[model samples]
Target: MRTTALLFSLSISFGSLAQLQPIAADVYRWKDLKIEKEQTRERRQVLEGSARDLDLLEIHTSALEPGKSPHPPHTHDDVEELVIVKEGNLRVTIKGQSKILGPGSVALAIPGEEHGFENGGNTRVTYYIIKYRSKLPMNIDRGKQAGGSFMIDRSELTVKTTDKGSRINYFERPTSMAQRFEMHVTTLNAGMNSHPPHTHRAEEIVLLISGSGKIQIGEQHKDASVGDLIFLGSEVLHAFTNTGQEPCSYFAFQWN
Candidate 1:
């Protein structure tokens, strides 16, 4: 009877900590986001939930005033962070190394790394932050064995122009939270489709930065504008097209 009672108690305790629901494939419009004003910056909460292979996934954006910082350098023991600059110049420090990144730049901080950001330009700096905790066990040592932390300046990447559009290749690497993390920017010409409807095993996010477009996932379609984000679940049929009169550019990132 005592063993059975203990099991019941354990089950009840475990049930209280239920897993977070998986995020659905949808669009988060920039205009629809409610801005939360702060002392140094304004924040827009994007999404906060679990993904297919991640235990916790959170995304948000911040616009920092000139010479302002959201917080001091911090370390995440289990979560990995990815920051993408959208406007103005950002000063980012990772593991004691600092760099000034312009719009379209990216920074990645794996588990157990100290990182921080600040607006280094005269104008306000707008950037997105993506944090994820993988369902797999966190292996800090393995992450360090890889590249640890790094930043990519957009100017350093070569843009390959295609007949349909242009593509800027970013990084494809393994992190503490994902077996594979891949990112790139695609500029689709006006009225051009990014590609035919396709599916992949990795969940993906499309962050539109320029012009306007439409993203279709399954039977649902959503129009996107600058600062809007489109999230596609794993193996979900999705496609994107430039619906505006000018070219559209967006960052496409996927991770397992």
Candidate 2:
């Protein structure tokens, strides 16, 4: 009887451990630029599953064709949406105003607001989308039935580039629980470097989107190519330099 009881207890413990195992990461690639015209784009990458799923969901290096856009103006009562333009141009309509978002531009749409997007340039528009989730389940379709409209005029967004070649654009500040920061890096024609060695309160993850560069974190530095990802811990001094013939472009996000 003693032996049987011991085996049963061990089995229960093992079952509980299995349930606590983490979820795997899932990556979705973009095959085309036009599929659903009314909502969603053709060229877009989506990351889902346990690894990508956190308090926030981020879409990186997303490319949208000229005629395609995401879902109609909709509000999430429990989540905040952030958009950052990396390349090309886009028209973003929020409430009743339209703004143009060019490379290095960032915008934030609070929860319960109406928003939409449309590509304005001839080339594909690439941008990053970050959605912050609440502890409770988000009602994405909220306010659709009332007189409140979910669609925003595509002509309301204005486009402008920052003078600081490549600089950090933050949508959400770092908090004790979960924080997100994003930035765009544009190398100069003759190649330049970012300095003054700075550290912050959150960890950082970088994604190289265009051109080539080298990232120096603490005493370690390495060459980075397109699609390369680098992770740095909090309070780690880091900087980057443009090392390629053409201008190098990249995006980074810091999470706390």
Candidate 3:
């Protein structure tokens, strides 16, 4: 009877695993906009994953062709956006300051802040966009006629930034996870194609979407490839580098 029970458990586990689906590629392609005179060609929006249970939304990969631009300067009064560059370079205009972001770099645009982007480089630009909405909206309009107004209050929102090897571009109040704080990860490739050695107040998990490198977490420094995941604890000095011929790209989520 014990053996039969064990076999049944194994079957259930396999069934659960089989039910999981990878992030769809078609979702990454942004097709709602018309191609104009701009040099931009390709555009897509891929929904990587989301944790509805934890109020977390993850947009795995988004690409913009050379000379293409996203929406004009806009703001989400209640949602916090974290963007991480995967390949090529992107020019971000935040409050009129234009900065070129390369692979492994990240930026955070606060609610009510004017922000937008353009593929300022010759290569295609891909990046990860994560959105944390305190209150999920009842309707989502993907068309151009949809109202561009925000429904939440901006003064009540709080924001913060931290610098690890990859920068913690922006953060709000920490979410409580088993008595620990939680923050979104926004890793950028800046110095020497990698980040510096530093620790943080919360634990973190990393997912590599592009480039190649090694992740040093505590004493375990392991090779990182596309689709690799790394977990880190609070106060653990972690770092990463671009070990491949091209640039490295990844995102880290910190949860205490």
Q: Please state every model's RMSD to the true fold in angstroms.
A: 4.1, 10.0, 13.3
- Across 1-256, the per-residue lDDT of candidate 2 in tens digits comes to 9999999999998676445422221112233223333235643444421222244443434567886676566766655666767678877888867776777566666567778888878888877676655333543343232223222222343323444353443333432223333343443332777555678765555666677777787777777776555555557788878788886666666543
Judged by lDDT against the true structure, how good is candidate 1? Answer: 0.91
Prediction 3 global C-alpha lDDT = 0.54
Q: How do these models rank on lDDT, best leading?
A: 1, 2, 3
> TM-scores, in order shown?
0.92, 0.54, 0.45
Name the candidate that leads on lDDT: 1
Q: Mind giving the per-residue lDDT tens digits that candidate 3 earns over 1-256?
A: 9999999999998776445443221212223422333343343433433332223444444568788786667776655566767678878777677878887566666555578878879988876666554323422221112322221211233333334233432333332112222334344443334457788765455767656677776766677677455645457788876667664556556542
Lowest-sum lDDT 10-residue window in model 1: 13-22
Which ranges of candidate 3 are over 4 A from the true structure? Answer: 1-53, 134-205, 209-224, 227-251
Report how far off residue 166 is in candidate 3 (Å): 12
Q: Indicate whether candidate 1 or candidate 3 has the larger TM-score.
A: 1
